[model samples]
Target: MKLLLSLSVIIGAIVMASTLTCNVCNFRFLFVCIGSSSTISCTGNCSLTQTFAGSAPFFSQQACDTNCVSNTTTQKENVFGLNYVKTCCSTDLCNSGNSAKLSLSLGLSMLLLWLLKCV
Candidate 1:
């Protein structure tokens, strides 16, 4: 009986530590150039892309242009008996500017409290 109780406690602890969690993150980048055409590439959770073309309403037709690209990528790994989920992505792509590489951030779930409660 004592051994069974110990096993249960350990199992509960592990489960609590493995609980799922959520995270919120946002980022941006800027590019400058003579023209309004540019190419952007990202590996991961690529989400939104906004491009500004042609001259501004108030500016001349020869004015500058702009663009934005975004994406997302997810990866999983386990360490020290804990599991981790990594998500990364870009917010936007720019035109006529230098090429850029954006990486997304990873998040972890918190389950310590839940494990203790099970004990």
Candidate 2:
């Protein structure tokens, strides 16, 4: 039983790690916007690219970044004075700039609690 528990915990971590969660927000529809912001709520795999015109949102999982500032040059894109944010994160809902990172944040919290219990 102990071994099984350990295995499960490891598996859970792997699953979480493999899963890519990001906050996707696009305000490109509005031209010459003063201030635009998206609600941080939506969550999905890093492989998602629905808000693009003719390019892949994320080239690969490695392309995703939890630290928004660090990957701003790549993930956080600005076009025509509008923003097309695809904030990617590996650690739960680290992408706090768009509406798709809430669920991942909760999932990360749950995972942490579970790990603590296992210990």
Candidate 3:
């Protein structure tokens, strides 16, 4: 019974670790967000969207999305001369400006150790 309880706890930890953490921010004129940026944890994917004015990037937003679709559209608004690119990824901190990679390595490592102890 104790072994089953330990296994359950390890499984729960792995599931919790898989939740996506995205950088949530809105910026204008540059992708390097001008002001403060924050992070959000969600069960879905992380999205990074950028809007362009003519050929120059003018706006950007990053957030946790439930049903984000990845795509690029050109000349979305001819009158406003606007275009956009959106990307969605299912990894922790994927929408952050920095290229740091966060994963369930620690959780998996713990699970492996627990299993070895059981054996």
Question: Highest TM-score, which number?
Answer: 3
Encode model 2's per-residue lDDT on 10-42: one tens digit a residue.
Answer: 998876666644433332221211123233322
Locate the minimum summed-lDDT window of 10 residues in model 1. Answer: 56-65
Candidate 3 is scored at a TM of 0.60
RMSD (Å) of each candidate, 1 decimal: 24.5, 17.8, 18.5
Q: Roughly what TM-score does model 2 have, to 2 decimal places?
A: 0.29
Task: Give the candidate order by descending TM-score.
Answer: 3, 2, 1
Error of 1 at 33 (Å): 33
Q: Find the 10 residues in a row with the least total lDDT in model 3.
A: 98-107
Model 1 local distance difference test score: 0.30
Superposed by TM-score, candidate 3 places the C-alpha of residue 32 at a distance from the truth, in angstroms, of 4.0
- Poorest 10 consecutive residues of model 2 by lDDT? 26-35
- Number of colliding residue pairs in model 2: 7
Ranking by lDDT: 3, 2, 1
Quote the lDDT for 112 in model 3: 91
Best by lDDT: 3
For model 2, the stretches where C-alpha displacement exceeds 4 angstroms are 30-44, 47-119
Clash pairs for candidate 3: none
